[model samples]
Target: MAAAVLAGAAGSAYVVTVVDRPKPVVVSHVAEVLDGETIEVRDGDRVTRFKLVNVDAPAASECLHQESAVKLAELLPEGTPITVVRDGPFVAVSTQDGTLVNAALIAAGLAVPSVNGTMFLDRAKEAHHSAAEQRKGLHSPDIPCTLPGQVRAITEAAAAVEAQPLKGTKTELTVAADTAKTAIGLVDQLAKPGGLTWDAVAPVDQTVLLAKVTKVVPTLYRKEAELRNVVKGLR
Candidate 1:
């Protein structure tokens, strides 16, 4: 399932398959970074490995090697539950606020952007930018703007009350139904053996009937529980 990446406060819409009924969830601790692409997290005895999707960083043997790892390490702390987009075997890592960190790294010339399973760009640019002024090379360049720290972490409280999916909404549904011309005959008549099918609206008034159906309803409901969750930062 795809997880929505929040690019900014506006957020981006992404569709993920719903495998089960949606439930509120949270986590507390993370284990360690196995590599630039993989991280191991511990939930008590249940250790889960998350493979970062959409991008890859340099192997330790590469030029930036230690520098890149150090940067990722600095951004993360021990036991920080990284909120990730869990898709099957891999967890796509977005930023603490859902910004695309790996892409940002590539954009800032810190790491090469891997595409189609191969590193498309060479270290020519990365080396030039990261070669800190050690003369002997002891400097690490300051990170650029728009890199997300903590990668991403959904706080114990709700990040924001997610708008609940639209369901059982009569007004909106009625408007939708009214706009479409479909025969809505009696259930019994439709089910009859030799079906006595007839137009339910024998004398349909296009305008009057449309107005009588309903008004526009919102996308979702805001319950008190959801409000509390928003304040608590748990959605």
Candidate 2:
């Protein structure tokens, strides 16, 4: 019975030792950048691909895709040493200077927060929120290719159209009717799914919509002026 107890105690000690062992530090150098959120790293003779946890960048066909990739390249230059930690299916990468690359991308607005099993996810989400609020990178209104920028342009055009003064003369009424008809058509187009009012309008389509609004606003103003003139004549 004493031998059995000793054997059990020894087995428990062995299990505790194994469980308490620290994980090895993984050190690798950047070999190639796949995109804003993925990179290939070289560790001696082995090269492995790693996706940045808690961040998702624009795809190749999306707006700001190239810019996002360029920013990532700047952050992690070729041969730059990086520390990597596995977080579920993804990995968290940090620079030699201790800058978290995943959070950096989000803070720059080049990437959005992604659902990941990592302790850094909340920090990354905070960075993303700040970037969006500041209108940095892909969220900037100065960038005509971005969705927010396009939406601003469309909203401005609509405001211009609505700013025209209403007139009450007969000739002006006729012109106003024509202008109103055109404006109504434009509004109908904008009311459709994926249109200017939608959250997913394409930049090209937004440009076309802006042009239509710009072209009609002048006519609307002219019609309103003519209608006022007719009213004056009658008075």
Candidate 3:
């Protein structure tokens, strides 16, 4: 009975030592804004580049890249004091006012949540979902360069093509085929990797956009196919 009590006491002590220890953190000041999801912080004479965990912003040449970088600059301008907790290769940065910079980017819709095995991943995901729903920043439908706006454009184009009658005279059939071809080209452009119109759209919006395109594109294919066959017969 004494041995059992001693064993239990040892286990409790081990738990307290391991789980209750404070994590190491870096105290620093922002030296420069690298991009939306990266920053350089100076700790005395040491300067370190910190990439925010669990968020991915648009790359250079992508839609909203400038806007995202501007937002991060606004949040953490040069010389802003910050606290950083290292999580593997990335860090969770917080302003003195208690704002989590990583989650802030996601909430503002400038960045999407990415898995990095960080402790704050769930918070980042929640912020991302809210931003997408609110249509903030990159998710805004008002911006012509954004993914949502492009999807809307494609949807409208497809609708216009579908409205035209598939059965018509040779001239009308030829025009219909031409219109459908244009709409299909837009879809293909959006889906293609490394294309001019391609952007790293958020996964949530991507799922919704995929469903919409899947429903609309097949009808367009049928219309174009029928029109081409009729036009060929007329020729």
Q: What is the alpha-carbon lDDT for the whole of candidate 1?
A: 0.35
lDDT of 3 by residue, 128-160 (tens): 767767888777867776766766766776687
Candidate 2 per-residue lDDT, tens place, 131-225, comes to: 76677776676776565565455445445435544544455455554555555454454455342122233357557655665555565555545
The sequence of per-residue lDDT tens digits that candidate 1 reaches over residues 1-235 is: 3223223222221222223422212334557766655667776788887655444555654444455565555444567655454434444444344334343344333344333322212221233233222211112212211111100111101122123222425443333333221212211122331210011111232233223222111101223233333434432
- Report lDDT per candidate: 0.35, 0.62, 0.71
Model 2 CA deviation exceeding 4 Å by range: 1-24, 159-235
Model 2 poorest ten-residue lDDT run:
1-10
Better of 2 and 3 by lDDT: 3
Worst 10-residue lDDT window, candidate 1 = 148-157
Candidate 2 pairs with clashing backbones? none
Given candidate 2, what's the lDDT at residue 213?
A: 53
Question: TM-scores across all candidates?
Answer: 0.38, 0.61, 0.68
Error of 2 at 68 (Å): 0.8
**What's the true lDDT of residue 144 in model 2?**
64
After TM-score superposition, what is the CA distance of residue 222 in candidate 2 from its true location, in Å?
A: 12
